[model samples]
Target chain A: MTSALSAEGLHTYYGKSHILHGVSLEVAEGRITALLGRNGAGKTTTLRSLMGLTQAREGKITIFGEDTTRWPTFRIAAHGVGYVPEGRRIFANLSVEENLKVPLERGGPWTIERIYKLFPRLAERKQNRGRQLSGGEQEMLSIARALLLNPRLLILDEPSQGLAPLIVREVFRIVQQMKAEGISVLLVEQNARMSLEIADDAYVLDDGAVVYSGTARELAADDARVRALAGASAEEWTLT
Target chain B: MMTQLLLFNVTNGLIIGAFYVLMALGLSLILNLSNVINFAHGGFLVIGGYIAYTITPYIGFWGALLLAPPLTAIIGLAVERVLIRPLYGRDPLYSLLLTFGLAFMIEDGTRFIWGPQGKPVTIPAFLAQPLSNDLFFITGYRLFMVVVVMIAVALLFLLLRYTRLGVRIRAGTLDLETVAALGINVGMLRSLNFAVGIFLAGLSGVLAAGQLGLEPTMGTGLLMPSFIAIIVGGIGSLPGTLIGGLLIGVASGVTAVFFPAASEAVIYVMMAVILLTRPRGLFGEEGMMS
Candidate 1:
């Protein structure tokens, strides 16, 4: 089967400082691929480069077998790639309904009605401005917004970041559900154990290079390696 | 007799304020979305007024009024595509300098084309008459200007509130990167936004020509007041801009009643007081202004 997203020898830079150095990876169809890394490991950079937000200086990015290295961020999105950035970047002045209506693509399964059904909390606060919602609700709104694009591949940057443990589980469960519906996911997360639990495949990144790649179960078995590579607290996975 | 004088001045103030609102709303829209001050806004206004002057001899005032703004908007679109689009994502100083240069070029270009003279715009004969003796200052044309401004303002708000493109423009103003991520062509959005702003400036010119007459420097004279309106209203809030323009207009009107010499100075004073007390102007969002 063709990979949902793929990149080869990705070289990204911020000013003169190089971030991603010859990094390559693949996210297979209908699977969850967790990109694990410590702080400044270039996980977000990887996503940004793929989305054409940062404009990778040198790389080859292919989305669903089409070369997308030179595409703009909007074109990348139109090609069925939905990105929920690290900060959630919700339009604070806009209402939940307005936020959902922002994405232009409407010809998909993930309508606003389906999203409201998926996250009932969103429906309850539909009229409330984005700033009025709690952090968990904001995260859900961001997720629902991306879904409205009906993207084939959803790239989430640290969905569990800054959320309460309970909320993190709730978000993760939704991610798992997305996988079940046959949407490929490229999840960048700090919660290594929790991500690996549901992730079909895992790649550990360090210093902008992919250090390890294997089945999630294989990575979970090597405790010391996961700890040294991911630096995710074991307590993160203890809730479930 | 005193009450009548006050009423006259207040009505005069409202007409002036309506003009400011028309100009400032466009400035505010472009500022909100594009992050450029558009010094050439005044130039576009002058262009609009001049277009009306040239066409009025043939199409008449009403037709010129309808046609001039779109023509100006078309030129604005071309200006944006050629000159402004390249400066996006760069230091705002570049766009500022570029637009500042454009302002001079447009002013000089208009002067060269139309000649450096105040051109009288002929209004409809019915509008030239005072509405009634009790309110002699309320000429049919003045009332018409206010009504047109109200309708335009109402339609502007409705477009932003109800239309898909308007929703995207507002969304783009708040978070452009995310809007683009949602598959919006932000480049096209900026062009349309710049053109809409110029259209307002153009409309202001058309109406102002009927009241104040057309000259090369007419737009420059009104530019500062419109900027004050945007500042007073709040940088990011459209409703704030509307209120700000009216407030200053009324203040100037009231001041003219008591101290005729200080009419223009009063708006600057109001702006300073708002900046000192609120800093965000009347409607400005927090963290919008530096």
Candidate 2:
């Protein structure tokens, strides 16, 4: 499979502290690639670097075969990359419908109507402000907002953070649906088991380095490796 | 007779309040989106007034009113692109200090050019007339000032409500990074927003010149009220700024009726009371500016 996004030796920092150290990975076209690790394992930093929110000091990034290492966050996004950052980052003052309207409308199959259909709860609370939404509803809205961009590649960081197990299943369903729609996905998650289940390929990041990159089935079967590298407990890596 | 006097003062207060609204809205826009305190906003107002004053003899008052604001906005755009663009993402203190120094430069530059004497902008002869003998305090110019302010304000609200650019600006004010992640160029958005704010300031200068006349230091006197208006209204809210401006204007005006010396002090008192009680101002959100 051809790679949709490929990074070579990315090194990122915040002020004086280094966060990502010479990390490299690739997401194949029309497939889900999960990057799993414990908190502060540089998963978010890798996504941020690829999106150009945090510039990697020493690396090259190519998105859809175009060099995008130095591109601004907006330019990278305009090139068809959708990012749902950690913490939901919803505009608290905007209503659910207005939040849906925030993304620049790229021509695609996704529309506000389609988004509302996907998240019926959002449709029910269309007039409610973002801050009023429950954690699950906010996650749905955040994902829905990114979908409005019609990105060829979707990058999500910690979509399951603070969400219930049922909601986590719903989010994973959406990620699987995106892959089925021929969109490549780079999913960064601390919830390794659910992501690994849906993901076709998986990379385990440990302290800013990729310790494992192989088939998701292989990673899922290797319980010892998953527990050691991804920091998922025995209960977490096992089938629910 | 006493009631009429109070009415007259109240009207004067409202007209002044209208001026505050225009200036404060622009300040609020830049502050909300760009996080720049813009101490030189008053300086931009002075530049607008002087530009109008200089051009009125050639193009007439209507022509100056039409031309000066766009010209000032162009200057504002250049300033944003060259000077202020680099300062974003840094500490807010840096922009504050830069704009503070810029305000002095603007004042000095105007003094150097216009020679430190008061200059009045001529209004259309029709606008200079009183509406009637009974309400002589409501001169056609003052009424025109209020009307112009109303139109500008209405247009501003429409732009924010209906336009794509306006929605982006409001979203950017709340969460710019997300807006950028959605493929909107936030830097360009900020630049356009800064120009819009400056445009309002420039327009206020043109209108204020016709009413208060022009001097180098005229902007300085008005600057504090605009800040107070933002604080009184709410820091991040445009509607809050609007009501805050009008509230202070009318408060000072009503105070002038009973205690002339206390009129100027009333706005400060109101600000103090609001800060003590609401802290976020009348319409400000909880935990804002904390």
Candidate 3:
């Protein structure tokens, strides 16, 4: 399958600290790819670099056969890469509907009605300000806002970072729906079990380098290796 | 006797209150949208007053009123492009300092050009007539100023509430990065907001020139009162600014009548009291547009 987004030898920095050390990954067209890593393992940095939120010191980021490594975040977004940043940076003063309205490009497949249908709770809380929403609601709003851009590739950084188990399940359900809709997704997740369960392919990142890249089934079958890399607990290993 | 004093104060209050609202509204718009506390706003007012004084002799007061705002808008746009744009993403205090310096520069520049002595500007003869036979007689020129200011306030309210550009501006003020990420050119929106804000400042200056003495230092006197109005009104809320202006205007007018020595102190005293009570001022949201 043709890759929707490919990053080659990406290097990134914050101030003077180097965060992404020549990391490389590919997100295939119409598939969910999970990038799993521990805290401080450069997962969010990778997503941010792709979105041009953090300038890449050295790399080539090709989106749909166009080199977009030097482009600004706005230009990169216009090229059909939607990013749901970590911590759900929703505009607090704006109502949920208004927050969603901010990212509505001139023409896109996703409309307000469609996003509402995708997450009914969001529709119910549409008139509420972003600050008034629960963490789960804010996450839903973030996802809904990004999807409204009708991007060819969706990049989510830690969507379940602070969510409860039920909300995490809901997020996974939405990811499944996105995958079914034929849109590519790059998921940066610490919840390896849930990510591996839903993802078509998985890349295991450690110390800002891709340690493993293969089908999710293959990664899951190597229980010893997965445990070694992830330090998975007994409960996590038994998760079906 | 008390009733007469109250009536006089109320009329005077409304006139001054309207002027404060016009000036503070312009400052609030620029503050909210661009995150710039423009000390140079007073400079724009000086420019407007100068432009009106220069042109009123040839084209008359109406033409001066029509031409001054656009000229100030051009000056505003130039300032934004040259000084303000480079300071974006840096500390906001830097921009404040830069604008303060600009204010000083503008004040001295005006003095050098217009001379230190105040210049007199006449109210057009048509508006010099008295309106009523009673002691509450209103000059046509003051009435004209009132009407023009009200019309401007109404138009601004409608523009912010109903127009597409208003929607974009409000959205940008709330969350600039989100607006830009959505493909809206935030830079252009900011520039437009700056221009509109300075235009309003110029309009207020023109109105003031007709009533008050026109001089290089005239803007300096109005600056403190306008700032007080902004603080009393919420920083970004237009209606809040208007109410704040009215409250300060009336308070000062009443103080002048009852305790003439403390007239100027009334606004500061009110500001101090409000700051103690609400900290965010009336109608101001906590941590808004920060």
* Model 3 lDDT, residue A16, Cα: 91
Judged by DockQ cut-offs, is candidate 3 incorrect, acceptable, medium or high?
acceptable
lDDT of 3 by residue, B1-290 (tens): 78778777877888899888888888888888888888888889989988889998998889999998899889989999989999877888999999999999988998999988888887778787877756544678888989999999898877765565666677777767766665566778889988988998899889888888688877777778988998998776677788899899999989989898998898999999999998878878632332
State chain A's TM-score for model 1.
0.97
Query: What's model 3's lDDT at B210?
Result: 87
Q: Mind giving the per-residue lDDT tens digits that candidate 2 earns over A57-124?
A: 99999999999999999999999999999998988877788788778888999999999888999999
Name the top TM-score candidate: 1
Give the Å shift of residue B102 in candidate 3. 1.4
Best by DockQ: 2
Residue B54 error, candidate 2, Å: 2.7
**Native-to-model Cα distance after best TM-score fit, residue A107 in candidate 1, in Å:** 1.4
lDDT-wise, the better of 1 and 3 is: 1
**B214 Cα displacement, candidate 1 (Å):** 0.9
Q: Candidate 1's C-alpha lDDT?
A: 0.90
Ranking, lDDT, top scorer first: 2, 1, 3
Instruction: Kindly list the per-residue Cα lDDT of model 2 for residues B245-270, writing each as its tens digit.
Output: 99999999999999999999999999
